[model samples]
Target: MSGTLEEIAGSDHAALARWVEAAERPAIVRGIAADWPAVAAARAGDEAIAAYLSARDNGNPLTVLVGPPETGGRYFYTDDMRGVNFRSEKMPMAALVERLLALRGAADAPSLYAGSTPTPESVASFATENPLPVDTGVDPRIWVGNASRIAPHYDMAANIAVVVAGRRRFTLFPPAQIANLYVGPVERTIAGQPTSMVDPDHPDHARYPLYAEAERHKLVADLAPGDAIYMPPMWWHHVRSDGALNVLVNYWFGQRQDRFPFAALMLAMHSIRELPDSERGAWRTWFDHYVFGDGAVHAVDHLPPHAQGVLGPPSPQRDRMVIDYVVGFCRSGGSG
Candidate 1:
């Protein structure tokens, strides 16, 4: 794949600028230029190498990315990951091999991997081993596999993903940047992880007119090892592993003081949106007076109140509750 930050010129830049402003999406810088060494070291060993090979051969949906030639050309395509089951299972070499062989010639069995990250199996195991925290964070975990494609999805909150081995391609659009990006049907059971109906090259404009708008604001990044990508809340991104053994550790972060816009939206949804329409008027007034305020009245002025009562106390209980709710929402198919 092309190296990170493939900036388009002239009209492309103008179109991108409009899209960025319209969508308020996050920014991305490619060729971080510093994360390569660690990425190389991590993939150099036998155990790690074996883990990757096993995932690849068994149809586990993981992928790997090697560096570009110093002279520079597209990175090599290390594997094909179109159909591996990343959502349901990840197992030993033998089991994966068995499953792949069983499906061979039986039907349209595309010998590749495709599915969500933190598959159902992984989530279930995580929930039991380490209860998700409320208003806080989950226990840190590292995910390594091959050819897995995290379909078009938006993550709640903020996240930083570090590439340990291999390369990845990420296509991102802002949450508010909705015109050209097709949002998937929201599941009643799960929430937060919204699906994007975007397919970079040939997007369906008739069905999803907004996607055309989202497309105008598109940004693409091809990532390499040691490289970490930060996805701000509400931004939509579709990830495809561009290498053989792609190992990544994701850090899901909490809302920070600076991320008040997201926090305000979250707060408004939980507090005011729950109120009856007539009653909600008062909250809007408050929001206008406090959040969008007179030239000088900013959101921080209202934070003290939230810190005291409106949002309840700042403790692990609330954090855990939020985590559990979100996790459950995902498990139940919020992004289905």
Candidate 2:
């Protein structure tokens, strides 16, 4: 909603690595996978692409999300938010392709989506034939579906996704806009990650007025076959796939934490959120000095390095100590 996303060229491994390292926002790389066999097959036609995928099917049945035509291909929560709008069904790649082809021209076709199927197991030779340009040491996952709108959500790891078929529009928001995005329940999620309650496409401003602030910082990228988009860690993105059949392969990498940040946030909420206002203010100051502040690393400088212990620089021993302490404290009912 703010402006068009930035575009960069080149698809070599080094160039891609550099672009990812330097990017603080989403960037579109046009024709990044132009030479891929999947892209060529897609350009030929839907049937050709479907056949290309069927030829590589390894007989593994992928879990597909099926929703009625009333949902308009949007996989989301029900009106009461107590249940999901879609049901999960398992079908082989060839069978799934047939179902999609059959519903190609139907105006009220049910949504059929097979998301995040491991490329190696689901489509045996696809990864080998169409390799990702970067070397993230992570295997790619494939998403095949009809027109669908995924709610805005953030991933724990950085991502690079390439479009193999159809068209995709990515609407991205910065991590700082989390407060304005009206995030939904963390424990109850349609997917593994918590998504924004407000729909970016058709926002209900009356119910979620703060979402208007998030729109000011939005960035959008419309990608065609062979185009790719790079997203940094924890960046909220809403994805919409257009056409009767769409396919995308994405790699997620660079997650280095043993415990997720959200887990820590939950713990903090349990311990500190309901405290008295004065006590909460005191805790905020302590947190600023010891955690979020730029000068936190030097806060322990007054003490000798040998005496710093857990407050010292990061190391395997310190990490082990912290993990053990936290585990012991939790197991002992916080008595430690």
Candidate 3:
């Protein structure tokens, strides 16, 4: 109710780039993949889509996630959160299609989800025919399945997902809702990332009362063939594909970075969280000044660019020094 996904024309590359650079919210690029051969073929029928992909299949066995209908087409953790509900196995493209066709009309059919698989690997010419005008040389990945759903999860990289066949609904939330989403164990993550334990379709308010707060910050997008959605880095999103056959082609580009942010965060966690409450409060002030203040006193006006090193203009030696320090830290059992 509060936020909505704004739609923009797919041909507007300039607008797309602007949105990609500063998309404080999700945006929809309608008919972005309309010219894609696979998407066009899908318009004929599911068999057409299957045939096209099958013809292009390079005979490589790929990972396919399988789950029973009792899990309601969702690939997630068990009730006790010990392990994932679904299991995956390697299967060739043609065999996977045959199995999906056999179970197509069955009411009690098990779910089959082939996730974030490479488009070019499955169909060697896919990237050439369906190229997106985003960053150069960034190939697309395909997610094909039969009426399956993936739980809400955040990706570390920025994402643009194009629907090729069938329809998809994305229930999205901002990263700030991480606390309200009731996330499960990180180490036990099933779907490449730590996904929300609470099912958005049938959320148990009694068990997850905070989810209502997250919902207040939610935005939704329904994608048709050729439609695409742009999601910024670390934005939480839940995706559900409808109908018999669904295929989503997505591209992920790493966020721009020039320094060792992850290493610094790890160092901070190692040193900061164990401090006493009073000392921890002091650390917050210190972080606000040093880390969050865009390298404040240590930058620009006070120090020359050469002296500023990693905090100011880029320095190759400083970068190498930081990398070497991290490598040494790792090799020496994290000792100072």
Best by TM-score: 2
Off by over 4 Å in 3: 1-3, 256-267, 294-301, 304-312, 329-335
Model 1 residue 212 CA deviation (Å) reads: 1.6
Span of ten consecutive residues with least summed lDDT in model 2: 8-17
lDDT tens digits, residues 1-336, model 1? 212343322223344344333434444433332334434455574345344434434233433221222301122122352322222334544344344444434434333332234523332232233232122254433454444455467766666555566687788776666545555544321124545555554566776666665666667777666455656767777777644334555656654643335454665576577888889988778767644667423444546654533233446765665566656866887662
List ranges where model 1 is wrong by over 4 Å: 1-38, 41-48, 51-87, 90-140, 188-192, 256-283, 290-336
Estimate the TM-score of every prediction: 0.51, 0.96, 0.91
**Prediction RMSDs, each to the true structure:** 12.4, 1.4, 2.3
lDDT of 3 by residue, 103-205 (tens): 8899899899888888767777888877887773467898888998889999877899999999999999999999999988765678677889888888999
lDDT of each: 0.48, 0.90, 0.84
* Candidate 1 backbone overlaps, count: 38
The candidate with the higher lDDT, 2 or 3, is 2
When 1 and 2 are scored with TM-score, the better candidate is: 2
After TM-score superposition, the amount by which residue 314's alpha carbon in candidate 1 deviates from its true location, in angstroms, is 8.0
Q: Give RMSD (Å) of candidate 3 vs. truth.
A: 2.3
Return the top candidate by lDDT. 2
